[model samples]
Target: MFACQVEVVVLTCEPLTMGEERYYAAEIVLKSDFVNGRVGLQVSLEDLDEWERCLDALEAEAGAEWPTGGRSAWLAVVPEDPVEVTVHDSPSTQIAVRMPIDVASDWLEENRLRLDRVQKAVATVS
Candidate 1:
């Protein structure tokens, strides 16, 4: 089993469509010990329906599809083995998603360009 750790830094809801609706956007970070790399994933949606649509887009973009048709307030990439997600009821909800290294690697490869751009922008601002 490939060991990995995943964390979500931010999940923000913004008004869209002339303030008629709200969208959810999140920033996810994955780190692996098996591989010397890290990945940051981001997604945005205009509403629950739009979130589901965005998730579909994500699957297609990643080239690994899932057969689920619903809107999820939050989702995480987890390992094939048994895993658990703990959510802390705090001001900023904290969730922990555990996945295998291989899965993490695949996600990183799929989002390399976007992740690299985010990292570069962060570096420039720092």
Candidate 2:
């Protein structure tokens, strides 16, 4: 059992250019009773779909790690009785936060819908 409550919010998805390369950025904000942080995740349409697949195939002993496209920050999901969401930010110092939330019947569907919305938003950003 965990004592913290975690909430992840996707603020927006926008196109970003670094030098000559382009990528879609997802502004992810994570909040919990123990910690709060934000990250700009560089992802493609395929990445979003991959995440959906990860969520779909998640199991109690088999967890999933999100592709953060960074070495310092990372996110993972652990499927227990109460799903555990953990985010680690270690640009200079390590700050790892974990929280557990009850998995309602619609939780997975809700997450898939959120990912679909993000994919659409990314596709429309020109």
Candidate 3:
């Protein structure tokens, strides 16, 4: 069976000011039989929130790309028939891998749950 897993590890976070804004340092990990890529980048809460929205509203022609502008190592999900997941390294590395996975019908729900866990984890950071 093919497998694709994405994980976001919030290594540390700092308050941007005396407000709710935070500077989050996170590592995005994508793993499968064909790819094992990790990208470390700075993210805002909006980035994570937007990711959730993307997954929720995913469609064949409307795929999702994290970190939006390829500013760093990024991942994109192309929701074709089998759901293609692509992992790309920053321009310096220039390495990319794409693989199709046979996911359950509730894959989006599962991913949303995983992201929710990450969100909760980030909330506890000091």
Select the stronger candidate by lDDT from 2 and 3.
3
lDDT of 3 at 52: 78
Q: In model 2, where do residues sit more than 4 Å from their true spots?
A: 1-12, 59-61, 68-72, 90-92
TM-score of each model, in listed order: 0.24, 0.72, 0.70
Report how far residue 26 has shifted in candidate 1, in Å. Answer: 0.2
Q: Once superposed on the true structure, which residue ranges of model 3 sit more than 4 Å away at CA? A: 1-21, 30-35, 59-61
lDDT of 2 by residue, 1-126 (tens): 112234543335678877766667665576666556676656666666778777776733578877645543556778787778776664635766776766566676777777777777766764
lDDT of each: 0.34, 0.64, 0.65
* Index of the highest-TM-score prediction: 2
Please give the lDDT score at residue 65 for candidate 2.
74
TM-score, model 3 to reference = 0.70
Model 1 lDDT per residue over 61-125, tens place: 43222112333323433323332222122223343343433335454344444444544544453
Q: In terms of TM-score, how similar is model 2 to the real structure?
A: 0.72
